[model samples]
Target: MSGELLLVGSIPLDTPEDVFRTFGEPLGKYLFAMPDGEVGPRRHWISRVHYQVLAAHPELEVVQRPAPDENGVERQQPRNAADAWWFKVRDGIDRVRFGDPGWRLGYARDAVNSYFVFRTMKEKGVLPSHLRFQVSIPMVNSVLPPRIFPNRKDIDKVRPGYEAATRAEIAKIVEKIPASELAIQWDCSTELQDAYGAIAGYPLEGAIERNLIEVRNLSPHVPREVALGYHFCFGTLGGWPRFAPDDLGQAVKLANAFVAASGRPVDWIHIPVLDRSDDLFYAPLRELQPQGARVYLGAVHNMPRFEKRLATARKYLPDFGLGAYCGFGREPTSELPNILNDHLRAAQIAAL
Candidate 1:
């Protein structure tokens, strides 16, 4: 009996149709829900979309552009400081108000569009009838990151509007898609980074509490019938992991906070696992209080250490789903097959 499998949103496939045929068709049996692969612009994660949203705000101005890379090419919307275009409140503007005229975050639009394909594929039997269409959305802090906003005051000014926009997006999604056919996973990278103190100038004090407040705010927007999950991430913007923590202590603590703060029942939680196989690293998981939500450990990568990591993780969490540390969107398209294979193989190993 294989354990459950979770796909962390982005897939490297070119289109929703391809993702459905490729990932959904094969992995459908192992998965409770599936994403549209977050193709095209979303393949780079939320950065590209966020850049567009922030750049369009009338009160925001580009204060600094990313320096050119070694290849002498400067990315217009880089994910990190090294490649990101920094923004600030425009001169004479005391407050930054996003979505003033109306902000289009695009998650709802994309999810609704992709859902059509998902429904079509299921009808055609290319996907399992039981699989819900998963929409992976970035948390507010992730979209308006400290790296891009820099100033905590600017973040404060922009948060309400962005959050309102997010809630509206969720409203549209729930209205268009049936609750039973949908699952929403809030991706948390910046929040975790702040909690870990990895992001410079981002205060660690009360970081977990702040993140919990976000969970409380957004999780309620997702109707109780629509499956809700949280993806605790370290980010793969600049690399596989923008920051590697000493252990799972902070991640577990943060996960616990999110679960407790969520106003509604959480269907699942995805916690990324580093490549460490040591007991000390996995021990923190023992303290994870998941309530009634299913837990998925992202211990699929770093194959050579897979067994050790799984064995250690099992000692603390005897029953949990398996997933990659992050999405496959940033990986080379050529690696998709192997990545899929790895998930399947990891499931088999977990069953043993």
Candidate 2:
């Protein structure tokens, strides 16, 4: 409930250069710069080490990866974006199977996502008994199923099994956590950015409304008292475009419109507050009250300096939280800390 807090994307698993040197050739060139994300002994150990460092902060909380598949879908547990897109194509196909007509597999996949995260946290010893356990589902940007299954058209259309699959997943995760400790966050990568316009199977408004519907749908499935948050922003990976929603003001307006339409209450709307060049929307942002919507404007960047970055946050003033800007500052490691401090400062200044 306090504003003086630290929020971060997942820590990168350390994949040393030497480890990649053994792989040899052109492949070796790729190894030196990859992020050692959650996977394997080294990453697990890195989390442990960082956990200890973060332990003393009192205000810091680390979002860690869930356990590996018991079914063995992952190979070596890649560290970082070294292979983030490694399964992009395959995943598309996998979801398509149940995606057609009745969303036969949508709910199933959603359930698996929760279970996998719960189990992964269990294995890593990262699921702190007294911590805020945040698990992000790739709703708009990444996890959405294909637009169609040409041959059939019964239930595969809307939201896979509609909200049934999502609710089931929500229920399962809540059951795993104690009533007092339950927290779930919807990672809405594909909300209202403008780029979604270019890649259209669903209209921009339609796409957004549907996703919000999913969020509202999932809410009742979880405990009434548990905290729910929505994270949104423009994103990119490996220098390639990932997604593009509209500007901050546009997003704010759209959100207000969406909320008005849905009539649901979301505890937090976590957004990229600082670092964006567009400053056209705060008036609009300010116009919309946080009566039911508490805006966590992301101010953090991947940079390390505190004062300079925190100043950036104050400059934005009640606008954003520094987070996942261009997908967590994908190019540099030093930027993360700076970005994070900016976010914390926003929370501090925003009284949120």
Candidate 3:
């Protein structure tokens, strides 16, 4: 069977028009959905918006600033500590309450604006009419990560307000876009990191449960008619493959938990595949129970590794879509064509 393609969000293009012309135009046939490349500030993912939100909060303070490297140059923000800022609950503030942080997250506004370009492209016959305009939103914990908050207590205190704001963002997006033409993907990088015991100063105990709680809370906000999906990410904040587990056991367990906890029908689930193809690594996929949701494996990075990974994955999954481990927004613009080519090649291989 010819497997479908999943663009895990951001396409690294300059504009929605550019993304529709360059990415959606050529790959629309293979793609079930595509994003506007998360152009402008969103190219940095949640950090750009999160920083603005956190910075404006009275109870929070920027405690750490990017330190100069050995070369005396500050690194780019959000990629690593070089260009990032850390926040903490103000010393005098006994409790942190972001009561209506009084700003928009920019997701809903961007999605509505980009959808215009998406629809235009489709009308021009540049993109397939069946393609849904994907809108990827980070889980609250992902946006306010332990790395940024550095305090679990502070995150607990701040999460409710942030989550409420996130839900509102979803509400706005759904209100404006037709459910059938929209797909909402909740990016779960930080949750997966915590589940893997990868986050510092955070206990791994109940991490999966915590993630499920958040999933249950956020999933219902997405209208039943709107396609809902979860992108189970290991993260790419500092670098790719943030957590290289010996096997897919933990990921599979987490995926199962997410599917079970989500109140509505999850249209799809995306799990990142490592570069290695060891049977031991992909073995836990045998335990996956998607519950009717389409499964997409992130197995399109290295062609050679992809072939081997796909072979191993097929032993258990049998059938699934293909995608990169995460979005291409962080990559240089020059590399997008190659990334697009990789997806095309993987699709061809999957068909074979």
Candidate 4:
């Protein structure tokens, strides 16, 4: 069977409608569904969501610290310095408490708006009839405490409120949007951290099993009727992977772990294949047993070696869809069309 196309959330576009109109065909032709392209300021995804959450609760205070480089070198810079906003988070145990958190949480409202746009585009013939609206969410474990709280005690104190608020936000979405047209993807960049045994204070002894439990807990909330999927990520900054894998072994193992634990039918699972990936990088996929969940490999990139990468990927596991390593929101706006074009080209090559 030919592989379908999957968009791992954001597309750098002016609006959701534009994303549908511009790439809908190349997408509709090969994709099973379409995301709203995470248009507007939300192109920053987690950061934007964090701002919204902080804005609603005046109790929380934005705390800043020196920015740490990939090498752990602390750089003294302006709070608003390049990529410095990611490290700022509201820190206060009392303020972190969610008192009957409501619609003000942001994510549900965004998903609802995106779904309306999707429905409109579908009615106007921009999106295909069968296209389900994709709602991508960064897991609370990956977002809160980790990004916001550096102190382990602070993480323990704050995580409950943040998690409750997140669930409330999702509950709001489920209340509004029809389950049949919704697909919830829990983006897992921290899973890579778990795989590498690098999650600081978090014990890696049972990290894989712990990650599986998180997925299982979140998956059940989606309702068996709705589509639930996992995107095993390696972090992304400026459209580039944060960590290059030595092999897909860790990702493959986690994918299988999730499949075995998630009880509900996972409509799909996306795995990233970086620019430098070769057969060795993909060989571990031979152990990937998704049971029956569709696999979408993040094998698309802006390179002439597209066919070569796809061919190497096929050698280990031939049936899978196409996607970028992560969202293209951080990339130049001008690169959007070219990225779509690359998807089309990669899709063609995969068919051969």
Candidate 5:
């Protein structure tokens, strides 16, 4: 992991190359992730993407029901529930059928556009030729269907169609972008939830194995030449973890499972380190040894004395690179420079 700095997808900027320019060569020289700045709200990042896909299908319906509230009374829908739409299969159709859902989905289109942007930057000497364009796609089971289908049975019924559509999306990206120039990252938020038993619908028995099966199935489509990685995250909103992990043990176990089941050469793995800057959280890293993939600890943040956080992480996992706990897309645009500076400062410290 020497001379490496990882961007954990998305930056609070206007364009992709702006991420490189803001950080300048010192930070970008090692590694760069195409900023998903246009992704509107942070919590709704995948929700918005799901909305786009659900809207195009005539058989699916997006209806608003009462918003769940702490007290029984319905309150105004939360922002995530407000703009984000859910899916419903048409009545009389016993099963949902997908015919070329990839054409209607925009995951490949976005990745392809970002690839072109990276190529332009590299050709103009704005980015190093070694810099790879990382495309982060949410795992199919991670976000959409659970929101739309409350019952596990319903989710199971439609899961295959949705997964196939996502596989198709990956196939499209692999077909269009040169495998060498691209790196595909599977974002595993909900899978983490399932691992911790934080989310319902997933059966208690063999939940982790079932989740790994999804990764094993979806990851191989990237082709052996293309770089592949996994981002095991707890949900993030407004620059904070939705559910703080007691420890990273579950994430560590999950990473080990993914690497074992992936059956492909995983280039890297990103694990979130919450607001805590203590040895207890980093302790699990000692046991986590992903055979070939380099590990990046999401130990960087905007908190005061955050460098100590990086120091603590280095103390436990000395060879790992640094990244934010999650993407900074929902953070204030004015904070972008400071966040970028934090990364630069940490990189400098690590290089020492």
Candidate 6:
């Protein structure tokens, strides 16, 4: 039987100036069953790495562009998750791939995800108290252009421009999408410490420091009902950082982690446990308890078949509404669907 579509609560929205104007309003969204209004200027920034990589490896186009980054120029890349497209690269000398203004899935997907929610509400004439979404992986700073902390006069304005642009983009989402429909899940990928420091030569402490600051800024703009959750894990980026990542145990001990108000401790953690056929991190994961929130030990890893997936989920998190995790496998093109399916299956099993 063909499986039904499962909702993935998280997706990146394509930001343009017009979209920013709608923050906290009902009628600003061009997509999503929003407050309502006229369509705003559509701005889809080109995915630089996707085009370049797609051109170089047409076969992997299905996977997505494995973006390029300067060893230390600035910006961050999307590591592990099913859809972290490469946004920029450092070392301006390379001309290895092409980028395009088209290929806009975020815009399309934003509309699609929003329509699902909005349409349902329309039919029933009911609106949800809050619109929940996974905010973009706020962890990757290396992929972005350097936003020198102090703002240097000699440096190119790329960082500041992107920073303003990003704010405006979020602002747009804020103005248009009602505060009632917003909750954020900050995916800090497991590798908040060592991996990033080693790979991009970014200071782990500084990176974590920066991330928390961003979160603090984002929190004020969000509604009180908007649940703010963090997904922490040791991430694998660029397909170069080897797979088989682990819990951010080493990193968690650092000050970067803040205990939530509830009492559990160890920073907000989410580790990929079930991969291929093994629940590698299950036993070790039990020790993780972040005070304010709960950590979901990844019950199913490496996307599983329908039967095994269900059996395994029941085995791990039978009483929770947590997500499933199957670490990246093979390549992005082929694996994302399987990963997505695992997410769908998890959602289905949860409902049952």
Among these predictions, the greatest TM-score belongs to 1
Candidate with better lDDT, 3 vs 6: 3
- Write the candidate numbers in order of decreasing lDDT: 1, 3, 4, 5, 2, 6
Can you write out model 2's per-residue Cα lDDT over 126-166, one digit (the tens) per residue? 33223444444344223332321222232133334434545
Reference-based lDDT, each prediction: 0.85, 0.40, 0.82, 0.73, 0.71, 0.36
RMSD vs true structure, all candidates: 2.0, 13.5, 2.3, 4.5, 4.1, 11.7
List of clashing residue pairs for candidate 4? none
Per-residue lDDT over 1-352 for candidate 1, one digit per residue giving the tens place of the 0 to 100 score: 3229999989988899999998888889899899999998888876666557777778887777667677988665464656676778766777555452222888888898999999999999999888999999989888778777656578777788778888888898999999999999999888888889887875788888877766778887789999999998988877878888988999989988888888899999999999998888899999999998999998989888899999999999988998998898788899988998998898788778
**Higher-TM-score candidate of 3 and 6:** 3
Q: Is candidate 2 or candidate 6 better by TM-score?
A: 2
| Cand. 3 TM to true fold | 0.93
User: What TM-score does candidate 4 get on C-alpha atoms?
Assistant: 0.87
Candidate 6 residue-wise lDDT, 269-330, digit = tens: 44443343334433333334455444444443444453454455345434333443412322
Candidate closest to the true structure, highest lDDT: 1
**Which is the better candidate, 1 or 5, if ranked by TM-score?**
1
TM-score of each model, paired residue for residue: 0.95, 0.54, 0.93, 0.87, 0.87, 0.48
Encode model 3's per-residue lDDT on 1-352: one tens digit a residue: 3228888888777789998888787778988788888888788787776566777778888877666677988543554734577888877666555444223677888899999989888899998888888999888888888777667578777787777778888888888899999999998888888888887777889889978878888898788899889898877767887678788888889999998998889889999988988899898899999999899999989786678888889998898998899998778899988998998898899989
Deviation from truth (RMSD, Å), model 6: 11.7
Worst lDDT 10-window in candidate 3 = 94-103
Q: Rank the candidates by TM-score, best first.
A: 1, 3, 4, 5, 2, 6
What is the C-alpha RMSD, rounded to one decimal, of candidate 3?
2.3
Error of 5 at 127 (Å): 0.7
The TM-score of predicted model 1 comes to 0.95
Clashing pairs in 1: none
Give Cα distance to truth, residue 253, candidate 1, Å: 0.9
After TM-score superposition, the amount by which residue 153's alpha carbon in candidate 4 deviates from its true location, in angstroms, is: 2.2
